[model samples]
Target: MPERSLAAPKPALIEKVLMRCAGQCAVCRAWSHQTICESCLGLYARPLPRCWTCAARLPPAFVGRPRPQCGRCLQTAPPLDRAVAALDYRFPWDGLLQHFKYHQALDLRESLLERLNTALSAAEVEAPDWLLPVPLSIERLRERGYNQSHELAKALARRRGLRCKPEMLLRVRHNDRQAGLKLEDRAANVRGVFAVEPLLAARLRGTSVALLDDVMTSGSTLFELAGVLLQAGVMSVQAWVIARTPEPGDE
Candidate 1:
């Protein structure tokens, strides 16, 4: 008898299994078929006006502008041409992201990715030529066992039918985590830390690209990464974050 070849499980089947295994909503703890119950999502992730370049929540006064943007972004533009955030990094999402990013609870990925997909659709975000996840340094990758942003980017690429380039950008230097750093110091921590992969640099020229990340806090990392891509000659860079950290006193 010949040995049989093994086939991989379907993505839909895998997602279904993960959803069922969640058993309850991560936010409200309500028993639900999905990882996050719809009610909790509705209450917490309500769409809000945000800066087109930075994804910062826009004040009511700024609403209805032809192109909405916060004062900071207007005075000095960010490296991103456009930005879209699925939710705010507050309360339930902040805690949930900690678990998803630090605890190896990858089952949350399906729910998270779906939220981002929905936001992008609602925002009418154009599909870029390539989707690039901010790269993690070799040492960090060894410790974390995975790059959460890469996971999110790959899923988004599959859903949107764009090329996913996980290694196109390299974290040439490993720096301290941005969480503990002061807002003023965060930019310094990430400056000159990212570079485009030399062999792929030529291909990126004059192409539109999107940077996918699990969260954007202070925009330091994304800004630095975007600047590098722009310097590498990409025509445009968009920031797509699952969550954005609101500034102090921001609703």
Candidate 2:
């Protein structure tokens, strides 16, 4: 009898199934096995038109004015020359951000970075001379064992071929969390909390810098840090945040 040929081995059924649904999407509960499914992202994660100065959401009909600024920013300018956010700090993003910052899910860093990268591209933001993380206070750094903003800045800088300056901003003291604070009081909490690193100070002179942060609740923290950068003679300051808190009920 002719030698029988062996059939090619088949992949395990369970393996196929696992590969089919790697993880469920957090927002829509779809079996995309990704951080978020395309449908959910298409529906909820679409970027909003933002105010040029503060990065707050603006209406689609809005057109940037003589300077491409919103009413609030036009009335009282932000320290940032420009600012933008990836998401509206709502639903799935709020949860994802909490995971990135407060929880130990370090894997979320890559997902968040990917989202931020996509946003930067979609917004067509300009590259800056320096990319910097909003620094954590020493106590917070020791407790967390990682600075989310610094990690983000480094990764983003690589994508844009910019220099990541993690040491550019120093948070001198830990302030109460801004999560629940009223807008008026938030500024007071973060005021005088940031100072530029003296040795690295000279590098910022006459150079445009972009600040990276996980979230922007109020403008206080970024503003405070930008003030110091401006004092050090930074030509311009811009901010890129993963999420921006929407007005109450705007969620």
Candidate 3:
């Protein structure tokens, strides 16, 4: 009889270390199981009252304004119906975001979800029928090996028991980064860059969808994705992102 080879043993040291450090963020000393420490999390992530329509930070004067809409959204309505952000993208938070998006810190998904979940819980909004992550271009996906937004959406859906539709919307163009661009240029950069798959369209008909993304800067990308969903007959499109960048000259 031929002798059978045994399967290789798993690494026990790494597992032991991770277990000991459970719910602790090494960077911020936050008691988190995944990424970011609690102290850093509190210092970096803080909630802000924002315009429901555009997710822009609400100025003190605008606090009492009924159904407040930002200047940009008031002049030209965004494609999406509503937007929600978990925290402001500034300071140490921005550092974490840079690391996650550019350096590919996959473990950051846990912190992202924790922050998003808190925001969702506090908001006075109904859950959507479907959750769709802003999709990446095929070429980009091939290079990155994963879409960070999709990963976060999957975790969120699991936590809330909502259906996560990863293939519903897609980025058709590999456009340039919008980080440093002017707001006007950002809109043009992302215009006509997203489309909904035909099969996915059928599933979205008359359904409410929550678009999940890691961050909302100029919000051109979310607007573009919402346009595609609306064209596909989605009843309403709402956006939920981990962070929102405050525009200059806006309080």
Candidate 4:
């Protein structure tokens, strides 16, 4: 009658596409959000019982102990008062992170943030007043075009209603990537690389902080950053990371 619908109703096309998108899981393209919906998350982000101070896997013997921190933390405390990580840095998570951190796949950052968000929600933990990303040095920042940790903090801060102070902690020096270093050498690699902005001294003073990062390998980078915050008069320090690597021998 009215030239019959040559254009296939715009609204119908939009609805069809939107429906397809809605049906696909964020991490895995699938048909079931209700059934295997969290498939990707379940496979890649299932939470593991971890050392309270460092997020290291709890030793088999320490499974139900009263103290949750690892033995090393018991001997000598870590800089952060507490810490937690979403997943162990391996498998699909590692590959996803490589894309986010190195390949300029910015969208993947949100997936990592979701994993961290899930970790915090499932744990009986306190939220910090300030969330700061482990900053990048000027040289690296220029090259990467973005700081994965900062992007993560910003997204999580919105979800948690916390302040994301990406610039509060400044990377004064550039350190080599900690990926390939031996466990013993990792700590030394990041030494003296992070400092807090003097202008924020009063702002950060008395504020509890949670250092944010993409991965916690030896716990050195975050540990170093936490110490700087505490030294600057922050009341307390905690760490929240997208992933925590297993101890060397556990591999």
Error of 1 at 84 (Å): 0.7
- List candidate 4 stretches off by more than 4 Å: 1-37, 60-67, 249-251
lDDT of 3 by residue, 88-185 (tens): 88766677777777667755656677888998897766789999999988887887777888878987898899999788787777987788787789
Candidate 4 lDDT over residue span 39-92, tens digit each: 666676666778889989876777666548877888989987888898898877
- Give the alpha-carbon lDDT of every model: 0.90, 0.81, 0.80, 0.79
Write the residue-wise lDDT of candidate 2 on 73-181 in tens digits.
7788889988878888888888888887877555566667778888889767789999999999878888888888987787778778999868778888889978778
Model 3's TM-score against the true structure: 0.84
Clashes of 2: 1
| Clash list (residue pairs), candidate 3 | 23-32, 23-33, 24-32, 30-37, 30-38
Model 3 lDDT vs. the true structure?
Answer: 0.80
What's the lDDT for candidate 2?
A: 0.81
**lDDT for predicted candidate 4 compared with the true structure:** 0.79
By lDDT, who's the top model here?
1
Instruction: Return the clash pairs for model 1, or none.
Output: none
Q: Is candidate 1 or candidate 3 better by TM-score?
A: 1
- Model 4 C-alpha RMSD to native: 6.1
Looking at model 1, residue 223 earns an lDDT score of 94
